[model samples]
Target: MFERFTEEARRVVVGAGRESAELRHGHIGTEHLLLAILAETEDPAARVLIEAGLDRAAAREAVRRLLGEGDDARALAAIGVDLDAVREAVESVFGAGALDAPSKEEPRRRGWFRSEGRAGRSPFTARGKKVLELSLRESLRLKSGHIAVGHLLLGLLREGDGLGARVIADHGLDFAAVRRAVEVTTG
Candidate 1:
């Protein structure tokens, strides 16, 4: 399916991985895909996003914050671990902000998007994968031979339950509005 993705579309996919990695996230969620699409400033999808009031980096930050800024802390709490308490204990022993310091071990930054393997990488979530699949459907529906950025954005819009699509809706954009915007930009 990826064979039909245009170079720009492929970059968006890879960029989603990089975004997830950079954010220290364990999975490439649909939100990361939205960020990747927004990062592609030259793409029509991105331009449509800009017009819809969700331009690049600032919008990315908003999406992350909206998706629960302290997600890891909450996750730890769910497993009967108080992250803040643990952090306080560590800080009392090592001094304040001890965890903020970088480790001497510069961990190797391997990309998750590498095709050879997916193990131990930030794998895409089920919804994220679904968005990619939907992109193919979108391309076919539009009578396009290749999956482009617009198609990818359309996929995000179509998958309305995903956080990425929810974010778009939160920003006051419905799927139809987004589709029309994409069409205008592509034309």
Candidate 2:
């Protein structure tokens, strides 16, 4: 499948991995893919997104907040949810360090090896893989010889339930509008 990807399409896919790694995530999600697509300023998909008001920084921040990563505390702070205060309240109700109790679940392993035998690499989450598959489908549907950025964008939207698609929808970019833009750009 990768063999059919255009250079720019390949870069977008690779960039998704970098975005995931930068976010300290163990796997690439649909959100990471969206960020990567938005990062490719020269791509038609990216230009359309930009024209529709999706900035890379803001989208990345929004995805991070939505995923409840390190930014979770900051997002909570914005809503006046003092996590520290919550911890304190919990500790006051139950003894000290009550909120800090160790979990029984084993700690996840981290090293230069994984189940797929890729050294020190993360895998694509299920939804991410689905998006790629859909990209191929979109390419075939459009009678395109190679998978292009526009097809990838269509695939992301066609995936329907991916975080990337949801964020695009949240920004008021409906499927019809984006499809039209992509078609125009491709032409």
Candidate 3:
């Protein structure tokens, strides 16, 4: 499948992996794929999204907020528990790196000779894999021999239930409108 990806499409996949690593995520989700496309300024998908008011920074923030805080945070906030304030207070007493330490989920390295856990490597999540598969389907549907950024966008939309879609919708950009823009730009 990767063999059929255009250079720009390949770059987006690579960028997604980089994004997942940067975020310390174990897997590359649909949100990371969207970030990759947005990070590539030269990509047509990025241009369309930017023109529609969904730039990289805005999208990134949305994804991070959603993933970082999650449902637990929302429930806590509703009950008047301020997680940020708690973190701040804890850090104030325990020093700057106190509250910002690595999560317990992260594997700890053991022994001098033992190699560190592959924290920097992130595999694609199920939804991410689906998106790539859907990208190929989209390329075939469009009668294109190579997968492109537009196809990737179509894949994300087709996946339908990812943070990427949520972020786009939250920003007031309709999915159909984004699909139209991608088609227009690629065509």
Candidate 4:
């Protein structure tokens, strides 16, 4: 699953895992991934949340609540989320093969270490590649050097309307604000 991420995106996952482990006193899970996506300082995802009114304190509170911790433990516990569900959610959000199985049109390819005949700059993982593609699109649109975290955030914001975007919007963040913030930061 980790194999499907770009270097930076992989790092984001790793960082999220570490955070989740710290949160649960166990191992990684989807909650962690969601938190990681929300916490990704260098990625645009984080920026989008920020622009949308997901203040750091509020985000932390939401994460804590989602994890069934803090003073609202009973309320969170009542929601009831098992490890498997957590794992599946993580996979779904991260595109780590939890759901949305890859199709034959884009068969799963081997990574640099596994591929026997490749000798070029290793390609990004599926998630990373997607993020990069989004970044590139943003870059081309904005005409800038490489991709920035803000561009990545804009990309995620633009991704087919889904939970992530819904969550962001719930907090009052609009795509335009996110794009403006990215442009300002990049500029």
Candidate 5:
């Protein structure tokens, strides 16, 4: 699944894992992915959420509540999350093969390894990564070829108990609204 994603998407997954760990959480689920998406503020998907009036701070608070942790830095340190394990798990979830050398003589595809000077590293912050992972898993469950912005929107819905979801709901946004927007725009 990671292989099928663009470099940006892969970064989202990685970022999500790190953020999940910071939150003292053990799983790289959809909630983390949604947060990851938000963390990457400049990304189109993030822009969409922001435009939809999703409050990042509020969402974070909700996540804290969902995790049953108080709003303190100590809460983050309580969990011993394995970053590398999270990355590996993200790769595994996406069906990515080992990160080894490609077959000899295989022609490198255009745009492969080309960052387009956007950034040497991913723009996805740790929180954004969490959201992205959640979205990616959901997209896979729906058998999508690649993770789309729409998937991210839907992932926010799946995190119903989280802060982000509540904010979205308060804004009168839901999976159906997001899906309609995506369909109208993409179609």
Candidate 6:
């Protein structure tokens, strides 16, 4: 299946891994894949998303908020919880990055001399893998011989339930409209 991926599509996958690492996330998720698509500035999919008002920074912040990263403090505040104060107290007692500790769910890979429990090295989450599979379906649906970045957008939009889709929705962009635009622009 991977052999059918165009170079640009492969780059998007690699970029998704990079994004997961950057966020210290345990597994590759649809949010990371969306970030990769936005990063590929030369792709027609990215151009269409940009023109539709999906800013990368805003999307990244949305991802963080959804994932309960440090941005969760704001959400906590809304409920009268002082997450910042709690984090500071916890960190002072447990040392820094205590709240950012890697989850046990992250698989440990045997390196040459040690185990690597890093984020990007982990496998994709189920939803993430489904999005890739959906991309293949989208390509075949479009009569495309190989998977392309545009097909990925179609898949993400079709999934319509992952954080990637949520971020798109948060941007006030209509999924059907974006999907049609992608097909029209990249077809």
Top lDDT model: 6
- Candidate 5 residue 111 Cα shift, in angstroms, is 24
For candidate 5, the per-residue lDDT at 26 reads 46
Residue 43's lDDT within candidate 3 is 76
lDDT digits (tens) for residues 118-185 of candidate 5: 32222333344445566677677767777765566565565465555665665576767665654443
Model 3, range 1-187, lDDT digits (tens) per residue? 7789999998998889767655556678899999999987887777988888888899988987888644556678899998668867888898764744364454565521122244345667778888999999999988989999989988998898988878888999888988887877765
Clashing pairs in 2: none
TM-score of each: 0.72, 0.73, 0.72, 0.45, 0.51, 0.73
**Model 6 segments beyond 4 Å from truth?**
70-120
Across residues 12-70, which tens digit of lDDT does each residue of candidate 4 receive?
54554455433442334333434555666556556656555674456555655444442
Q: For model 3, which pairs clash?
A: none
TM-score of candidate 2 to 2 decimals: 0.73
lDDT by residue for model 6 (1-187), tens: 8888889989988888767765656677899899999988888888888888786777888998889543455567789998658878999999976776475564455431122354326468778888999999999988989999998888888988999999999999998899998998566
Across 61-176, the per-residue lDDT of candidate 2 in tens digits comes to 78876785446566887999977688678889997757542544544676312324343346887888888999899888878878988888888888879888888887777778
Among all windows of 10 consecutive residues in model 1, the one with the lowest summed lDDT is 111-120
In terms of lDDT, which candidate is stronger, 1 or 3? 3
Error of 2 at 167 (Å): 1.1
- Residue 73 displacement (Å), model 5: 6.2
Per-model lDDT: 0.78, 0.78, 0.80, 0.51, 0.56, 0.80
Candidate 5 vs candidate 6: the TM-score winner is 6
Superior candidate under TM-score, 3 versus 4: 3
